[model samples]
Target chain A: MKTDMSIRMRTMLYGLMCVLLIPFVFPTWWMVTSSVKPISDIFAFPPDLLPRTYDWSTYQRVFELQPFAQQYWNSGYIALLVTAGTMIVSSLAGYAFARIRFPGADAIFMVVLLGLLIPAEVTIVPLFQMFNQWGMINTHWPLILVPVFGAPSVFSTFIMRQFFIALPIELEEAARVDGLGRFTIFRKIALPLAKPALSAVAIFTFLHSWNLFLEPIVFISTPQMFTLPQALTQFTDAYGGAMWNIQLAAATLTALPVLIVFIVAQKQFVEGLAHTGLKG
Target chain B: MANVTLSQIKKQYGNTPVIHGVDIEAADGEFVVLVGPSGCGKSTLLRMIAGLETISSGTLKIGDRIVNDLDPKDRDIAMVFQNYALYPHMTVETNMGFSLEHRGGTKTEIAERVKWAAEILDLSNLLKRYPRQLSGGQRQRVAMGRAIVRDPQVFLFDEPLSNLDAKLRVAMRAEIKNLHRKLKTTTIYVTHDQVEAMTMADKIVVMNAGEVSQVGAPLDLYDRPANRFVAGFIGSPSMNFIDGVVENGRFTAPGIDLETPSFTAGETSRQLICGIRPEHLVIGGEGISAEVSLVEPMGSETQVTFSLPEGTIVGVFRDRIAAKPGDILTLGVQTDGCHFFDPLTDLRVE
Candidate 1:
């Protein structure tokens, strides 16, 4: 009776899952198919599963319309910097909060977590003014610095704190006995054990900087300085008309690298996480 | 090997005093075991000695130096934690050699020391395996091996065998004893198991409620505990207590009477508690009559639970119990080995 019930439940779950998958899968499918289709045939009824005809020159138009390669580099390097910076900052703060015993440590950690409650959109006006005052406006500095040290990093810090709090404290004790000072133990012992949590933080921080459309549009005015997300919207003809083929072509390029990175590194870090649940 | 002295050591966590001021002296090359119930502050005192905990109000000296503020590594002690605390990422050889590397040992020196420890622990063949690849007993040996590679001035073990199966615990107990004999290190081990303490300790410190109850050799504590708590805690089946009053050269309770020695003669303290061990009671003898409540038989001996007029207590008889439950067995208590405590103070009386 239990097996019968589970079988029916599983079939129903799969049916619901397939139904839920269409909205997520179809848009990417449409975007890729429509990027190659002639702009006239894009909205053809009973949407094409495969492109009916390929106008391969649309890809060339993506680079011709804007410095697409430059924008791609801007997003890539900024995301990489943010990921690396957040990993270092958050892990150190998280380890100290979780393991160290100092005066008012808990109170200080609570104050840091308050950053997570505020979003970047709410503080953009002041941030823009500060960056403008420093002559960092229209540069990638605001994009790189804000997310690494600001509210987004707080979420990463919280993830790292939760992971470190569950970590076997005895390992640190053993390291201390093994002649390691605090920083050495953090680097050699705590950091290696924290690969899974750090990977998750990396994925979040990278994507945050990669898909930062509002910040780019607000801070950067020149097409040369625009990130990929902002530059995708720049493929417009005169009289404010949208260039559909070139825009889709640019958008696809922006999304594919992130998708491929997730596919490759996810297996490594996911399995590493399974090994951290040991009681010791 | 060096002596470790903890003088009036105290521990408090934000005004909550967990370990009250206590003093213990472990002579050089002595194996000291701190045995107590859980939460009795045995482990706390060991951590203080290891420099892992702050000595709130005392001087802790190792050999010739006052190391109260020294770090664990600087104190030159190696500890085996209860869960082994092996670095999960490193191989067994690296885990054992990790300390030597940090202390600026050359690669060859570290490797040679690790190899020596591995050979001693029978882990020479498994040096390349990670902790996840080892079984519980093997991991325990690796933890010991890590401590051995350092060859520190002192060794500390915090209930390191509690995670193993019973048969393995017995075997490891012998191994640790043999290791202590060979190394002759000033060691402090903490456990709640009295049997482990009795078998392995050169000197035993029994603690209760953040205070030291007694300190003596293992056989000395078993033969003559200093208090009711010590008497009750040190024995295997635990010593049974009969509460009563002594008057006119005899101690008497409900259906209980025993001749008193003249040492407490005319003493004002009449209220008494008598203790006798399970193995001291002999069945089918002329003494207190008890109806057998249950009978548990081992091939070497039989354990019988019974009720006298006062209360229920357990007894182990070398001979087989002939009768079933509800059978009357007159049991004898070896009074020469019996103990008396003053009920008010719970301290043993002469």
Candidate 2:
């Protein structure tokens, strides 16, 4: 009934999969291995599957070159704040759009959906001008505030709205009869049941905030204020010759937290996206 | 306990009216059921009483307070949804005690009430488990437990047993009825299933297309339906209506003629519908000839579908009928069991 593959068929399938995995997994493997390889051997023939000679000094040089730890903290805190802020804003907006009935709700939701149409690049200049007038340039305010409140969160709000819409309305009715007001019902019943969608939003907002290069580079000029993605490019010698091994080492460190987060929350993330009701 | 009264309660979605002024009164500790086929607005009327849906117009009173503008929580009522609507994330105890918690009950008080409700619902052992961990019937009991934990003034149930299997539905039906008996709380139950309405309701409100067709005690409605709709809706197999005219003390149609009841004699040479329950059709006697079209043996009773020259009618016989399709069977109508209705208005003609 299962129609399971034979062992030989499975072996061949695994072999095909391993071969297919090379394009996706090999880069991370190379980046990790290349971080430990001697600078001269990084581009060596056949591309040493393992490091030929270990150069632990590259990791030391990564920290010595710039305020690497400070930059890591900047990215870490910004991502966390963005994740939390986006979660709050999006879940509330989503709940309102999905559940609450009011005049012009549909029109307002359509306007919000318009945010999904305009790419971030198209709004960057206007946003930069707006933030400049607010004296928010060179601060983490733009990095955090824009994603949490602006276009980036539109997707999160959309996801949350879809999730909240899929939820049974009877639960809220029952909660209302249980003496919960709208806010209390949202907090106690709706929000607790929204863990999957929230996780999906968290992962998305965190990764988006962490990998943000254009915004940080455009907004932040201070060395210590650079996030990981921006800081990774700062690992250069005086002559501006790219410090290959040091850069790779910093990039490897930059990838670590995101990797760990995804590993920890992959189940919920997958389920959340799947349950977003996007599939036909 | 409180009595619920709806005086001309109406509802409309935008310009479209759903409940066109329904009036129902459930005396204190009475079990009232709103029942009808789908889209009959029975559930909507129940929701209006529970304060889930806004009443477009008319006065809704819980006890003596007009509750038209009050929130569901302020109405002092608890409802069990059709799906049970147990908070999936919370344990049974927390779910049962959620209302009390919202009302600022002390933890000890909440725990005591939850314990009492759990014990009554036989969910004491399962209080620590989540709703997803319980069976359909257990989840149903948990929903009931949640309702009873707060001891609200009234209870509302919206097809609460509909999600359960047949056996569980019957068990839970009795359990709910027994619970109502013990608590003696004013309860309004809504279901489309006539069997549930007939077996469980102290009074049944039969609705048709957003209007209350009849409201009476179960047997009273069954014995003497006020209208044709109530007669058709209150029975399991449903009453079969044969269109005929009463003339010279005989009800005559295309290929059928029968002795009319004494009360129906005054309407001579008038068009009428004679409604007869499936069980009231006698299999053998001096009567109209009908050819058996289908025979369904349902354990204790054999349900036979017969084709009278005018129309098809169903009959339930206690004795096992060996008649197959194409066999002619003489069927007599129980004279006392006959109901005469005006064909034009579909109203009972006494």
Candidate 3:
């Protein structure tokens, strides 16, 4: 990258990259265009990259067919709660494991990391039975609690711990010598300096909970309690035939808010993750 | 300012003890340096005094208070780490006044103190800059400025200048010494460089393998080192040691023959270790003879390494000899600065 390449080689390299970008770019292109297409034209042999004819009625059916407004609120609030909850739990656990000299900390951290190896699908049955025993099956507790305290949070904790470890020990020691106690040091020094890591944790936790599909279908039986991903599948006709255009419309609505958020904060989201540079 | 005292201090991790029982009495407003090789427990001792590391045993007292159980904040000492642990998020003023904020100082008082410290450290122009924005020397001064604002009983510096370039290190070294003179606060510095210890310390403690090898004024240790290790460690280019034995009235080695240095408990016909400083060797004198192997001209002085029959010895002389690698020279120790030790024990004879 330091040296300038020849004109032919640079052209070939950019050509190769463009070819590799198609599969990732085409699906989103189709998803947006198909959402606006008429149902009959959705199955056209040469798919309309841009819809040949528009139908605003499919978007109207998206709200009428289900409690789409309520489902939107459900997914939004659950993702927010899960993001905030995961941030707290992960930062506390990660700072303790990385900075404190507690006995058997390494052993406890290893046990916690085992959660990463076990997929949530592997334990969903047991979790459903437990939630049912507590009469919480139709509630959002499983949706919120599972992602916040379950395997998804372990990755956040691992990332936070890695960030906190690279934090210079002298800063905390200087804080201590400056008359700050352990909790005060964590609050004023550690937390303020952990913005990049916490932001990264927030984005990942939000997207994970927002796109959560399996837990919602298993836990919630009511259409009103459906999350965005669960509600996206409910756009079907009377005989259970897929309403392809309406389904795509609901999917677009479900994915739009998060996409907008990503676009708005993409710089911080990517650079915060890329650097994680605790250059203390 | 307060005098710091450590009586038989020790530190251990599990069952492995890194600092054996040691005692140091740093006078009020005095600068004491703990200098040693790496892993010699000098930094551990400094941390123990700073209350960053707990003492596994023994007593430590600052002023009149027994402070072994106190936290670092309560110990009333300020430490400047080698890395200059300035808060990356805060400006220079905020970082320096952070301690005063915790100690219940008002906003005006904190600002005044920060301003005063910044002025003293010549950092007034840098009050708003973050740590990463400052150069290495400026950051180091800000670190010292942070310590200065506290105005604590004692100042602890853990190799504060090790990260600077050579020229900056010398400049900062003088600045630190000048700061200590102005403040007149008790200071405890830890470093591995002997020159820093030699030039700056009012009293220097030389440690090895978790034990205090020797402790005295710098020149006192230099003039009359307690053992072969102290003699070899205190000087640059180190001292030349010859393994030999003393028989009757004379001590003799392969190319060294001199009168045996006498001590209180003297024994004739015994194994001995003779230590001669590089600067103490006199050329063209009525003394022992050896062949020169190399002549290193160092501007004001020249270093000559002589190839003895059994070993080699190096000498730094102010008088430049017209000598090459194959030249012959007569070399003799000026017994006034000569050191003799017990070969078996590696302890000083006197």
Candidate 4:
């Protein structure tokens, strides 16, 4: 009798979990399935969950519509730059804020944390004007620089700070007694042990830069200069009607690589974030 | 080996003071232990010597050079920490050799030094294992190896064995004492355990409330503490202090009175505290009558708690005493071993 009840409970739990997972999993499924459907089949009364026929031309048309490959490259490289840059800048600044005892460190850290309070929308006008004055408006400068150095990366900095703070202080002290200076100790001891936090920050920063829409739309003008999000929106027709198939194809192209990478290395992805001292 | 001298050492966290002016001197190759209860600033003092803590105001000298502003690397000192502090990411060999690698030593030299230290620490087979993979005792050996491989001018230990279980702690304590005997580097060890200080140090400095109460050989501090704090702190179970009045070569408490050798010392009106170690009290004759409260028997000796007219007192006896609770008994104190201190200042009034 107990075994029967436990088996029933397990089945119910699996059923509930799949239901809970649908909200997050459904949109990606719809996007992929609709991307390959014929334009007529896309809006069929049944609303195809799986297309009977694939519109292969729609995939090629996504690239033909406004330098889509270049836009993909722009998003990929910008995210790479942002991830690398944020990892360096935020880790160094975070470690300093957490450990080093320079004069006015706490005061400076408070000012840095104040970046969290001001929304990017509040500073977007100034940032756009500043980038324009430097003739970097049409370039990928805003997309790369804003997330790496601005408020977006502050959360990354906060995460790194939390991890570094929990690092056993005596490890660094032992490094000191081993005759290491502050910088050497940080590089050799503290940073290596901080791999989990760094991986978590890297994933978060990359995704943030990858999905950026507002900053790219505001700063970029040339269609060739557009990032993936901006390029995905350019698939509208002259009548201002949505090009559903083409846009879905481009959105899949933009989101697939990261999704596939996450799937393959999901253990590292989940465990890295879990151990980033964000357990609470 | 080098001598370390701290003259007028003081530490302050912003406006709040932690360590008041302290003067300590560790001779070349001497094993000196700084012992005190927790929050007494002994670890802070050791850290200041290791150059991990900034000396708020004072001159710290290693050999003849003043090292007050020098970095820890420039000071050439090694320290073993309470938690061992092995680098979690590095293998035991890499952790031991990491400092030398940073100092621009050749890879071969670094490896050779690491190998040498590993052999000494019996960590040869475990050199490739990371800290997380090793047992606590293994990690502790790696921490010690990291310190010794540098062959620095001095070594600082901040209660390095305090985290271990009792059996492991005793084993490690003897190993450390043997290591010190072999190397003979000038070392400053800090621990709250007086037994560690007693068994390992050539000299012991007892601290209380951030100030040194006494500095002497371990037995000297045990047999003749300079102040009441040291007397109470140096022995296990602590020395018992009894409040009393001294008049005309006699000291009188509530229920106990005793005669002492005549001395024309301090003011007779001044109140004093008399102290006796538990071991000095004996059963029977030439003493006061007391009510037995409790008795605890060890393999070699029994400790009995008794209530005298003045207050409660404990006596340790090697002979088996046929006494139980609620029985009246006479207790004698070894007169020569008694200590008197000025109650107000807590300083010995010998």
Candidate 5:
């Protein structure tokens, strides 16, 4: 009963799961294989899964076409800054919303939640004008500042608030009896136990900042100041046609590191996200 | 250790009142337990004393200071929560010593204190383990260890043993009572379990519907409950209440008549709620005739449920009853052991 049923069930389940995985797996497969294919074979009548002639030149052209290294650094540092900044700002606000009882706290939280409804796309035009007026149009300030203080961080704050709300109130009460102030309790007790939520928030915030497209194109004009997303778009012909090989190659470089990291720590990444009270 | 006084303590949420001007005073080193059914304001009163809840419109004095506005940190009290509330991230040692570290105690001092508490709780070997690794009983001991390490002015417990299994709760109850005896710290405990209040408290405060019904020793409240609420709430299986009328110095109901030397004027014509504790009813007494409905043998004592003239009543007896359901039996209510209360005010008339 056990062995025959197990064999049949296992094969059927594996087949179904693999079939369901096609959409997600295919895009990544296409991106990696096309990045390494010769320019002609990329659009051949029969698409080549393995390039007949490897075009290593596209990878070299990816770096040479623009200040891709500097743009990579721009994306890297801005993501780090946004992650760190969001962790601090959202955690403090989230703790207050969850644990503190200041006057009009619910009203203040509702006003903060208004940030989530006003998408960055809706506010981009005015934000561009505002940053341009401040002579900050070409810098990374808007990309970093807007996420840390605006809509993206609100979601992080919401995740963190939900997590903190689930924490046993007794721990804080015990801390109070132990003579720790509100800030001390938050720093020592609440934040340390909130590592799962913090990691989840960091993953989300970093990804959001790294993939910013419309904001970078609207705010940045200089190639030297361009982020990776803007730089990926720059890998095109002078007539504005996409150099698909070079773009794909650069996209591989831009996306591979995070993919590899996520794959390696997939257990933590998935579990951390699940523990943030987001899933049913 | 210091005396804690709550004067006209009231708790109201917006316009709705929860605790309505209840007063209680705990002498230095006294063990007080606030007990009642759920939503009876017992836990709320304890939280107010702990400074976790605002005292709405009352003055709370710990020792000599008016602590209405004081922060919980400034109130100098330790609390043991029902869930044990040990820091899940910290080891038992760190969980115990964390407060001392924040209070600017030296590493040596914190270590010494943690060592002392661990030894007292027999947690020395388990100090390095986190809270999640500990069993429920171990976590309860660790919670008590955290409370005692500080030696705070008052110790507050909110149903600290309710989460433990029945056997473990009994062991922890004795441990807590012994610990209170040794430390002699002013302690206020809250529980919905009557047994915990009866076993552990020097004074038991019985509350109902946001009001203090009675405050006395465990035996005092058990022997002489001030009102119908107290009489019914203070004992196991609860005191069986039978509605009856008072006339000719005897309370008469549907099927039974009980004598009450304590029934007074203005209560003669009024309907009264007559109460009889299960233990006070004598089985096989040839008094009031009853039919045995069920018999539950609890090793040393047997609990017999019988249908009286008024309603089904339960009686606990030390003697084993070989009676079966539908067996005709006679029972007697020891009038002295019974309590009487006016149904209108629900207050004791005797």
Candidate 6:
């Protein structure tokens, strides 16, 4: 039944795809190769595909600049906390909005969705003031609490609500007949079936928190508290002139963990977004 | 096992009423069927009895206690949904034992009960598989097994076999009937297929437009429907209706005249509908003549559609009818099978 293409046609198609992959793949390749190239050869005319000379010192200089290890750990743990916290808060809120019937539910949902329309730039001042009053101005609390409970989670809640709405109501009804309370039904029945949606939300929240730049720059000041994105900008000379090779090495380190996470979970990430369920 | 009684039970969504006040009774250990066309509120009524839907007014009693406001789990009634509704992630054994686990049954007790239900349903080998891995009929059996594992006071099925193919449906139908016979548990099953109702029910409740049209034994309802709806709804191919008037001990229409049954002798010159089943039309006898419009043959019988000046009618005959379209066939009415309905009220004229 499959109408497979001729070998020659397939070969040509693959060749075309390889050519098209250049713009996306070349930048990362350049960043990696340029990190080990001498500073003079980084912008050499007719750029070298492979480094003619290796300066392995740039990788070590990346750690020597700022508290790079500390920043890396901060970004890692903050993203982990944000992903976990967002999943719980959004799933509970989503299940309630999707299943529970109450007065003013639609009105409340509309208000929550309004959070999505407002950009983080608009609320940064009031948020900074609020965190300053709580003595959390230079701490990681603002980074963790804002994304988990604030505007960023609204989108995750929307995705979870949509997934729950598409679920069959008969399953819940059958659980009720089986002597389960509302919370028990949600835990034993609904939550387990919502794995795909939850993974999708986790990936989105983790990536968003990992690459966060503006929030760290605005709220954090000391080098020990700096996240990776903010620390990547800190690799500069005393005159504030950018350290080209060291910064590229640091950027490569920042991009490595996320690339590995994506490659490992890409299957679930795609399936989660498509919202396929276990058929019965 | 227990008896279920509905006393003027009603349901409405906000301002619009769907199920008008309905009253039905299923005696202890009885197998009752609620059969109707789609959107006839049959499933709604069954859900109300299952305690899934709140009663707007009146009382519902399962055995001796009023269950109108009780939660579905507290009512001790188990329900099988149309789609099976098996927890897709759980294995069949865990699905069958889920309710017992929630009820704080010991692990050994839960396992034993699940094993017994699985053995009864022929699902012992499939216990390790998830619902998605099983076939449709197997999933249906697991759903039934999940219900039977509870051993509740009452069993409710909402179009449980409607998702199967024709052959599997018939097989499951017989299996369900046999299960009912063995358990003798009070059961309320809702389906739109009248064949399931006719073949499986000890008592059939025929509903139309959210109201009970007739409630009786299978043959009793087929032999004597309470009104036009019941008469048409109960039988396959439906009953044929000929609008006519009784005059001079005969029924007369535009192109037909036939002798009236003895029951209609006193009601002379009255307008009514003559109801006859297809199997009741005798092929060769002294009766009104009709032109054969279409003829279809099964291995056992031939179904012939006849066109008269008044309207068209169908007849099923055991004889292999050789006549094709445009052929004229003489039709005779069996007087004993004749039913009279008042045309204005659409009610049987006793």
lDDT of 5 by residue, B1-350 (tens): 99999999999998999999999999999999999999999998998888888988988999999999998888889999999889899999998988888778899999999999889889999999998899999999999999898889899999999998999999999999989988999999999999999999999999999999999999999998999999988898789888878876777776676666776544547577878899999975534678899999999999999897657988999998899999988777875876878778989876
**How well is each residue in A153-202 modelled by candidate 3, as lDDT tens digits?**
88888878888888999899999999999989999999889888888888
TM-score of chain A of 3: 0.94
Which predicted model would earn the best DockQ? 2
> CA shift at B97, candidate 4, in angstroms?
1.0
Candidate 4 per-residue lDDT, tens place, B1-350, comes to 99999899999998988889999999999999999999999999999988888999988999999999988888989889998888878888888888888788898999899988888889999988999999888888989999988788898999999889899989999988988888889999999999999999999999988888899999999888889999999987789899988877777787666666644535365589988898988678554578999989886998888887767988888998889999998766775767888888889887
lDDT of all predictions: 0.88, 0.91, 0.90, 0.87, 0.88, 0.92
Could you list the chain B TM-scores for each candidate? 0.97, 0.98, 0.96, 0.95, 0.96, 0.98
C-alpha DockQ for predicted model 3 = 0.87
The parts of candidate 4 lying over 4 Å away from their true place are A1-10, A264-280, B246-250, B259-270, B320-322
Clashing pairs in 2: none
Candidate 6 or 1, higher lDDT? 6
Q: Can you tell me the CAPRI class of model 6?
A: high
Instruction: Enumerate residue pairs that collide in model 3.
Output: none
Candidate 5: list runs displaced more than 4 Å.
A238-240, B245-251, B258-272
- For residues B1-350, could you state the per-residue lDDT of candidate 3 as single tens digits? 89999999999999999999999999999999999999999999999998989999999999999999999999899999999999999999999999999999999999999999999999999999999999999999999999999899999999999999999999999999999999999999999999999999999999998999999999999988998778888999899998887776566888777764453225557777878899989987645679999999999999989998888999999987799998887876776756888887889886
**How big is the positional error of residue B89 in model 2, measured in Å on the Cα after superposition?**
1.0
Clashes of each: 0, 0, 0, 2, 1, 0
Candidate 4 local lDDT, A63-108, one digit each (tens)? 7877988888888999999999999998898898889879998888
Candidate 2 chain B weakest ten by summed lDDT? B260-269
Q: What DockQ do you compute for every candidate structure?
A: 0.85, 0.92, 0.87, 0.73, 0.78, 0.92
TM-score of each prediction: 0.96, 0.97, 0.95, 0.93, 0.95, 0.97
Candidate with better TM-score, 4 vs 6: 6
Q: Which ten residues in a row have the lowest lDDT in candidate 1 chain A?
A: A271-280
